[model samples]
Target: MSDTSPFDPVGHESLADAVVEQIETMIVDGILKEGHKLPSERDLAEAMGVSRPKLREALQILESRDLVTVRHGEGSFIAPLSGRAMSPALLALYARHGRAFYDYLEYRREQECFAARTAALRATQSDKDRLRDIIDEMQKAWEEDDAEASQEADLRLHVAVVDASQNTTLIHMMASVYDLTRQGVFYNRRFLRTMDGTGEKLLQQHKDIVATILAGDPDAAEQAARAHLDFVEESFRLGEEQKARETRAAKRRKLSGQASR
Candidate 1:
């Protein structure tokens, strides 16, 4: 029952309460993610250095709180906790509304900039390694001209940055936000990619962000994140305008053809 273990030895007199608190903390910290299965009763009790009776009591408490789901044949598992953050009906509304798209970008700018700044200051070595690996994937995708892969890597990099921030709230929130983007709530996948030179520019912006964070410059990291979002916002607006112009041109062409007929 080392301190570093997710389930440490219970020191409190109320063993059941202590076990419950420890498990709850792990869930809140994102260490034990949604749907992760708990160990068997015997194994869990041994790991936590608590009696099986006390462990069972804690499990009952967690189930009552709706934090854990215990199946008859299967072991206990963390409940689905992300449903509140990712409501399908709300996401549908956001996808249908044009205004929600830009509003989401604005929200992301603030949250992502803060994440980048905090990651710059607090990221562990492992976090830095993961970020660098994502950058490598992005670079490879760009070189190979794989637009879809590049976009996926871009989303992953942003999520990784938030993870490095070590803030549980931001980690969960940004994940949901990006999930919406993946579902096309903000814009179509081809909106930015269809434009000339946009891919190259995006790659460069991503590079700058990673560079700043790797340098451990909090201010520079925040600035880089802001700059990247600003570019994306401008690009989206331009794309929308281009689509409008194309639509108008198509209508004019159809009218001319009809008149000739």
Candidate 2:
């Protein structure tokens, strides 16, 4: 994973896309640091077992996304992350595969519980203050009926908790998945709206988690965090079931109408 050896070429029709993904993975995983010079075009093409034209196409796509900078006659270099962690390709991958989102949530739930527990034991007064401020913003967002602001505040609260843990590794892990976190919140917003009283329940859940942490009760903080996620998981499950039932009923009605004709 550390070395940039030749990639094993899979027989996919979209070779250029594959090339883009491989390069993107390297960048994301820190194998290719910012401002690091990329291999020469010819060498890179050979290493990837892709045609030069295909490699050039992939580089162009990366350049378009600001993941790579192509200086004329100077080859290519990895671009500095200007606060952009989510690539269009990565977003497309998640959008195309619904199961990936569920898998991500399950992983996030565990990490979040640990973060909350650690935060309870380690948070400073300043950390508590920051958490409270975010919660205040969240409350205001909900009161104003601004879903987008509420969602952003919700993410900030969770991230703040993770930071409060004073665990650098945990912080970095969350940062790596930052894009997926935002996407999940946005995607789940539609189903979240369908669950009655969900907004109020969610607000209270956030408050409970923060209050437990602030009390320095690690056990309670962990429990509160897990309980909040349990509700979220259930909401998603119920929402999906409702959507499925509606689809089936619609199909039955269509079939009955055809039979009558």
lDDT of each: 0.85, 0.82
Give the clash count for model 1: 0
The residue-by-residue lDDT of candidate 2 on 1-261, one tens digit each, is 124464555346898899999888766644465677988988787777788899899999999999999999899998876344467786787778766767767887899999999999999898999999999999899899888898899888988998888776677577666656676632655457558464888889999999999999999999999998888788877877888999999999999999999
Q: After superposition, which runs of candidate 2 have C-alpha atoms over 4 Å from their true positions?
A: 1-91, 184-186
Tell me the lDDT of candidate 1.
0.85
Candidate 2 clash figure, as a count: 0
Which segments of model 1 are wrong by more than 4 Å?
Answer: 1-16, 35-57, 71-76, 85-87, 143-149, 188-190, 196-198
Q: Estimate each model's TM-score.
A: 0.80, 0.65
lDDT of 1 by residue, 163-243 (tens): 889999887667667767777667764567665365777788888888888899999999999998887788888878888
Q: For model 2, where is the 10-residue window of minimal lDDT?
A: 1-10
Question: For model 2, which pairs clash?
Answer: none
All models, RMSD in angstroms:
3.5, 13.6
